[model samples]
Target: MSVIYGLLTISILVALVFLIVFIFSVKSGQYDDSYTPSVRMLFDDELVKDDSKKSSTQEQKQD
Candidate 1:
């Protein structure tokens, strides 16, 4: 019972710390760029590779 209580206390402290850090980060404009991350992820490397493979297959079939 005492161990569980201690764990609960520790978890509450950790949660508080994370909450403070998140608030500070939000105030610091860390979450300002709402569009760039979404757009950047949409243009990552795998799509380019998949597109090239598709085009190459299309060319081979045409040949």
Candidate 2:
């Protein structure tokens, strides 16, 4: 049917757009740090070390 042809054409166009976007992202370093994200949670506490230090100082002042 004509409707089926139209749907197929639209789907292919959408898929090609997504492919181009993905390729652009890859070339722009979007996936370069793949490992970091997977291990980022393990280092979340380290990222807030200054906050912990601030809390400790506050606790000392309270004492």
TM-score of 2: 0.53
Measured against the true structure, the TM-scores of the candidates, in listed sequence, are 0.53, 0.53
- Identify the runs in model 1 with alpha carbons over 4 angstroms from their true place: 34-63
Residues 1-63, model 2: lDDT tens digits: 999999999999999999999999999998787788889988889869978999999999999
Top-lDDT structure, candidate number: 1
Q: lDDT for model 2, please.
A: 0.94
Clash tally, candidates in order: 0, 0
Estimate the TM-score for candidate 1.
0.53
The alpha-carbon root-mean-square deviation between model 2 and the true structure, to one decimal in Å, is 6.9
Error of 1 at 10 (Å): 0.0
Per-residue alpha-carbon lDDT of candidate 1 for residues 1-63, written as tens digits (9 for 90 to 100): 999999999999999999999999999999898888888887798899999999999999999
Give per-model CA RMSD: 5.9, 6.9
Residue clash pairs of candidate 1: none
**What residue pairs clash in candidate 2, if any at all?**
none
lDDT of 1: 0.95
